[model samples]
Target chain A: MPARVIVVTSGKGGVGKTTSTANIAAALAKFGKKVVAVDADVGLRNLDVIMGLENRVVFNFIDVIEKTCKLSQALVKDKRVPGLYLLPAAQTRTKDAVNPQQMIELCEELKPDFDFILLDCPAGIEGGFKNAAAGADEALVVTTPEIPAVRDADRIIGMLESMGKSPIRLIINRLRPNMVQDGDMLAKDDILDVLSIDLIGVVPEDEGVIRATNNGEPMTMTLDSPAAHAYLNIAERLLGNDVPLMDLESYTSRGFFSWIKKLFKRRTRQY
Target chain B: MDFLRKLFGGGNDGSGAKAKDRLRIVLIHDRTDISPELLDSLREEIVSVLSKYMEIDNDKIEIDLDRDEKAVALVANIPVLRIKRGNVDYDKV
Candidate 1:
């Protein structure tokens, strides 16, 4: 079967679109599924850096678009995973360097070779966002628990719906469970209520994610990371495993291990 | 047991409230493309319609727009004035 193309986008900046893309792609690859991480942000490309593949980007997304390299040649194989590859965006270019048609054709070439093509989208409601979304078979919208992020996500959902690419799944990232309990933060259900879509994952704010990205490593590459497990769980759930959403309290305190403890406690306490 | 549940169980209800309250308002603005001024004008038109009938009291009448699932509608209530309720108030007619 052809690969499923998914554009990971958030209408607002600093809301984890790139992070989610890198982690999810890496997680999917770790699950033994073929995966390609496409940095579609063009001039501001950073997925390669986040995935620790920046130094090795010989042929880029624009290279594939301009036909300077074969689509397979453009794919930079990840040293860490067998089937994971990256099609990095050109570093010194802007959004106008490639159009939506070029993106659609590029993904079409990649479809037969991979199990998943994950596009790391640029922020905002602009041309870059439009081009990144054009070829995706599915969309995974990332949003923070904050009001502004949710509002922008709603606008993006409205725009996608207007373009007939609707029913986008939501992933509420950077959630703080303590704040949520203290009535200071937006919860996952709250974010989902406004966006009104099926939720694929809820990522709790984790310092390890920031550290991993700074270290040029995909957070999903570290199985010990709380966020690593969440990403893997989401990827597994994507492959038709009915993993339940993580409990927020456990997430904020001890990460996934604590979350598992709470799950069992809830089961035992059910009287 | 009930109190323990109260203290811990429903902790994350704040976002739920914010979403329902704020998104409903924002979505109304998005879909209808109607400004507050338009809504005000619409309310005025509803009041005028009520006035042309029996002794309609505008002070007690309230008309507004609301979203019902996926549709927008003008929801209004025109209270019959005390005088109008007394057999259509033909006193000055």
Candidate 2:
């Protein structure tokens, strides 16, 4: 069967588009599906770094597009996940290196070999955005629960709609539930109301994500933290699994009370 | 402003709420390729045109552009204060 081409995009920068793409692709691959994540952010390529495949990138997206290397040569096989692959973006080239038509053709080529082709789109609605979106069957727009991010997400959705992108889903990244509960941040409902897209996943603000980034390991590799669990759930949802959203309240740290409660319950059970 | 709101008894109209409201209005304009100023002028024109036919409550009149997944709609809620009776009444006709 042909692969489902999904584009991960956000009009604003630093909202974790690449991180989501890397983790989701890894999670899908972990489920035994043949998955390849294509980094479409040509100039500022970081997906390869996030996937820990940067040093191994002999050939890149531009090489495949420019017909200098075969698609297989450019795909860095992820050893950690059996069926996972990463097609690094060209760090030396610009977005103009590849056109929209070429991107569409690339997806067409990869469709037969991979089960999922996830495109990590660059920020803004420029040539990069157009090229990244040109080949997508569906879109995942990632945003934080902030005004600027949400506003940009709305713009991206509108643009995608105009371009006839089907079934665009929302992924709220770095969501601080405690802040939302304290009325310091925008709630999920507020974001959903504005964007009006189907919710795919909501990742909590976890310090582990930063650690994972530093280590060049995606959170989906280990489902220990709330963020990792969220990414894994998103992957499951992507595979057509009807999983309920993670209850962030329970997932949040209750501080010393939970520890004391656990101790108290253990002592009472001894009787 | 946020500090003031924090000091005072701010209800749902916190910074987040304000952002939501602002984004809603901005998105409407962005989708329709229209500006807020243009929408205001359009409201004024619509009110003037409607006032010639009926007694309209300008203060109560609401005009906005709303969008869904497929289409965009210009929704106007014009409150008719009173209907001006024309020269030819329905009963007489």
Candidate 3:
């Protein structure tokens, strides 16, 4: 079967688009599916660094497009996962280095070899975003619980719908369950109500994500963290499985003792 | 006061609710591509055309774009004081 080209995009920056792409690709590969995470940010390359394949990248997507290297040569296989690969973006090139037509052709060439091709799109609604989304069959729109992120997600969803992309799903990142319970932060239902897209995953704010990124390892490779479990569930959902959303309360519920502890901590700080 | 509210579990409507309310109003304008100025002009033109046949309550007129699940509607609430009677010329106001 031809690969499912899925673009991971968010209209606003710093909303975990690259992190989600690396982890989801790694999770899918762990499920025994051949996956490649392509960084389409061009000069602002990040997936390679996040995936811990930066030092190993000798050629990039631009190299492959310009005929400087074969597609196979440009792909950097993940040493940790058997079936996962990374196609790093060119650090010296700009967004204009490649166009949507080249992106479509690249995805076409990757279709026969991989089971999943995930594009890590650049932020904004300009040419970079268009190039990343051009050849995709599906899209994963990432956003946080904040208003600005949700608004941008709505705009991106409108664009993706006009582009004829099917199964556009939402991934709400950095949700603080405690804040939601306190009615301080937007809940999952609130975000879904605004975006109105089918949700594939909801990842809580996990410190382990930052640690894993800095260490150049995907959390899915260990399956030790709550966020990793969420990404795995997302991969299963993408494969047409009816995996239920993770019970986030299990990870966040610290009971009355922790709340009382926080109360005293707040009181002590007033001095 | 915030600490006391947290202790009593008596939270107000919350900032999340405010955010949702703000987004709804902003998105209505965004989705319809209609600015506030455009809506004002639209209301003026509509009231002028209607005033030729009826005594309209211009100050009380309201025009808005309302959105639901599948579609958006241009809803107008224009109160008329009375209807004008007589044969009206097509071209002459």
Candidate 4:
């Protein structure tokens, strides 16, 4: 079978769409599946940076679309993962430079050799989002456990369903288990109730994610990081394995250990 | 504001709570492509039509619109003006 084009999108901004794209792609690649991560942000490209492949980009997604370079030429092979590659978005061109038909054609051409193609979509239901979703076989609606994000996601899911897309899944990102336990935040079940879609994964709020993202390293590269393990489990589930979800509460420190973490945080200034 | 109140229980809206509420109402209407002004006009027209046909207690009348299960409805509770007063005057009959 050819690659399944999964566009990771959220209608609202700052909901970890790019991070999920990078991490999910990395996870799939690490599992020995051929995956190509495409940055579809165009003018405001961030996936390249998230994947830490910005410095090596000689060509971009626009180059492939414009025929300035072949699809093979635009793909930047990952340094650590053998089967992974990234086709980065263009920085100099606006979204109007590409069309939905071209994106569909590009994905069609790239499907044969890869097992999964993850498109990191830009926020909003604009031209760029349309182009990104045009080629997708399935959609991973990334949303935070917040009202605004969930509402926007509901709108997006409705639109996708109206467009006759099927198997649209949800990934709740940046979930704070402590807040959920304390009744200060919404949980995974609450989100699913609103969207009423199949839940694919839930990622905990991990500070290591921030540390890794700042260093332009994908959190998935850190195998033991809770977020990484959760993402890897999500990838396995995506690949037809019915892996259980991660338990973030187990990772929470208590008693003496909790006191030590607080003391350490007090000693180190937060960035 | 209602949605934030419903979701976050009014958290994260302290500084711009009013603005966020306004935006939420506006966005909900905008995305649904429905206008509150249009609804108000519809209500006014319906109430006017009701008043023209019969004597109605306008103060106590309530003509409202609602969305239930993606369905639209006009719900009215109009009080009829009594033709006779004084507890139906049973003895006078």
TM-scores for candidates 1 onward, in order: 0.75, 0.78, 0.83, 0.75
Using TM-score as the measure, the top candidate is 3
Higher-DockQ candidate of 1 and 3 = 3
What lDDT score goes with residue A142 in model 4?
Answer: 90
Write model 4 residue lDDT over B9-80, tens digit each, in one string.
334323233333443454454355546797677767776776655667868877666554344556778897
Docking tier of model 3: it is: acceptable
TM-score of chain B of each: 0.45, 0.58, 0.60, 0.41
Clashes of 4: 1
Q: Which has the better lDDT: candidate 2, or candidate 4?
A: 2
Candidate 1 structure lDDT: 0.81
- Those runs of model 3 whose alpha carbons end farther than 4 Å from true positions after fitting are A262-271, B1-6, B34-93
Please list all clashing residue pairs in model 1, or write none if there are none. none
Q: Rank the candidates by lDDT, best first.
A: 3, 2, 4, 1
Q: Which segments of candidate 4 are over 4 A away from where they belong?
A: A254-271, B1-93
Using lDDT as the measure, the top candidate is 3
In Å, residue A19's CA in model 4 sits off its true spot by 0.6
State the lDDT of candidate 3 residue by residue for A1-271, as single tens digits: 9999999999999999999999999999999999999999999999999999989999998999999999999999998999999999999999999999999999999999999999999999999999999989999999999888988999999999999999899999999887776677889998888678899999989999999999999999998888999999999999999998888877765779987876675467434
lDDT, candidate 2, A1-271, per-residue tens: 9999999999999999999999999999989999999999998999998988888999997899889999999999999889999989999999989999999999998999999999999999999999999999899999998878988998999899999998899999998876675466788998998788999999999998888889998889876788999999999999999999999977655679965664464356334
